[model samples]
Target: MATPSLQDGIDKSGSPIELLWQPNAEPWLPEVVDREFTGWRQEQAAWHEGVALLNLSHHMFDMWIEGPDATRVLADHGVNNFEKFAIGQAKQYVPVTRDGNIVTDGILAREGENKYLLSGIPAAQHWVQYHAEKGGYDVAFETDPSSAFRPGGGDPKLFRYQIQGPLAAELVQRAFGGPLPETKFFHFTAVTLNGRPLRALRHGMAGQAGFEFIGDWEHAAYVHETFLKVGEPLGLVQVGARAYATPSVESGWIPSPVPGIYTDPELADYRAWLPLFGIEGKRPLNGSYFSADIEDYYVSPFELGYGKLIHFGHDFVGRDALLAAKGSETLRKKVTLVLDPFDVRRVIGEDQDPGFVLSYARHRVESGDGLVGVTMQAASIDPVGSVLALSLVDAEHATPGTEVTVVWGEHPGSGAASEADLGFPRIRATVQAAPFNEHARTLYRRDR
Candidate 1:
């Protein structure tokens, strides 16, 4: 077990940046699963024109909070308004530091009056669990870390499956042998399939109509095998771990933003609680953006699209600081950078496989005379035929059709000589809506 603590890790590295900038940082892909099913590119295209069945059972961790104070415990730390958070509805839960910088975000669903399931990256769960324990809240917390860290290294507590793409609804309806509930976005309902009940939430990746089903882990194998049998003929392709990471590029959600837990005196106790090998201490960084002060890498929720989700009607942990940052002219706006196809051919080369080029890649986004933004999660979608990178740039540079240049490559002195062999490549890109795909931006949640 990688023992010690995050504080010790940081102390040994001399600084947080030094600890994070490891040589050839590993891609943040799910463990215990094939990187591809049919092929990542084909799997990606399936979600665009046909249907994609993503096996999410192995990746995300889960936390169960139940008790009289469960709701209040979450309400105090979360930015999303909880007054009307209904029993079966889910929201994009965001928590920020005392200074209002984002800690992390996750999908929080209210399962009962005093029962909730908070699941996603471990950073957010750890933050909430730490507070729940220390604050004397009347809540019982249970964690089911992803299979990656589960003690037995067996099945997880729950199984998550997502059906998405153009024919998603039709395929699922066919499987049900009837009509699906006219569920709104982020809303879930108990649906029966093969005499089994599961929670089906209306959501998607890469901005398409989809449903994500969650249920006991015991049902995973049967449900998956049954779905694959029934869905294959309907153009349903199974998406694997490698291709699953690209959805954020098209869906516009930034995965694994550096948690705002380090360097905050308020979070000193948290660092002490975190293990050195845990996600926070071990999550490495790549890309062109490098700063000695790790705080420079931190971002606010406003920089991302979550600004619209923030509610001020009730007080929360970072309420005062967040209140002050509201509508600050300096905050960067999230945008998608469509890397030039020609430049991609020249720099990445014709033989470069698009489906596998992933990292904590941060490319510098420059607007003519000055640096305006940083690009993250650059990906080459099979359907889009061009590499699209989600970036946060100055508001003026965020307008669609604005031209910018991305200095593509990893940070200097951080890795293998092959990375250097790729050479310093600059590619031209255009600024567009955070979701580069039109379907995601216009029609995804339009019905809601």
Candidate 2:
């Protein structure tokens, strides 16, 4: 097993992923995005043709919560209901402070009936202990180093590599020597690689068919080496953090760290553990990337396009608050808008303006004015030739073809700017409809 590094910094030496994401004094050049993308495409193709693996250590959080009342403990602090989460199924929710600030949202996987694995950051553990004491659940939780891939519980780190595209399964089948048809989405099963028991989950963060493998500290190097050996012929390259940026963006996943969005005096308690949630050292907690003229940057479930998933029939942490504000007047609606690519390119270059590129779709409104929904995560899915933005607006405007205006740019005086001398660059955009790209992802079933 490789010796884990010190806890203060990311595993710079142990994991190549750290090197890939760093722009300077790193293996790849600072201009990697513009120059190396072509080669990255070649590698992506090779890996698709064979097998590709990624050390997901940088992007994961390891927390182990133990107690007789662990399950009950999680139920109290979560903004959403937890009863619906089945064993082995991943449940997502936001942990809120007493003041209603979103601390950080994360996934809880049912590891055992009595115990749960809350993956995201130490924030989950903090909240678990907080409510466990309040609710008298008798649960004790802490960040477990053993939860990491190495022994002695050194640095609680693990790696995740996405095997994607249409050929993902075939490549896995080739390496593991079996049919890959049995795995179900969000379901994980264990397998052995180089004598190490690796856990593979059939969840695709890329929005394509893919799997994520988890293991203890010893398997990282072997896994990385093995993936390269097996994937070379098929076309695989170690995808850097910059290259992975578009995939994360295209996946429409919400980002935790941003200015004027989650950071605020309201979220002071939540901001303490931003590092575990991958948002630390970025900037102020209650600021925003968009300036004053772009509309409110906050979001509710309605604007995040998850209204269908929000059930008010049961009591939840936020049930009373959500119910008190019920009706079209209360709920914000979410929308998917198709943006023009020409506008997005202007935001990417060195000489270009430091600006926001329609991060996520959301609506603007306040209580009692009816639902002025907000948007969540938005992406520019190049495969579909459209800039996709997800927004939450009043339910009345949720329908397709509803025209909405999107504003992008950095506010001049906002905390996002490192120096006071820096000027903000903002832009205005028009958006329309959901499913901005028709090529939604789905699991492949040949028999069906």
Q: Which candidate is the best by TM-score?
A: 1
Tens digit of per-residue lDDT, candidate 2, span 1-448: 5323222222332322221122111111223123233344443343333344444565455566677777666666666556676666666656544433344566677777777777754444555655565567776665553233234544444555567655667667666776554666676677887577887877654445667777775667787677667766666556544435444444444554122223345444433333432333321222112232211444444434444445555545555654454454645554555554555555333344323232432323222323344445554444445446655556666666655544443233332432232332322234454434233323332211
Model 1 clash number:
0
lDDT, residue 175, model 1: 84
What are the lDDT scores of the predictions, listed in order? 0.83, 0.48
Best by lDDT: 1
Global Cα lDDT for candidate 2:
0.48
Q: How many clashes (backbone N, Cα, C below 3 Å) per candidate?
A: 0, 41
What is residue 65's positional error in candidate 2, in angstroms? 1.3
TM-score of structure candidate 2: 0.68
The TM-score that candidate 1 achieves is 0.95
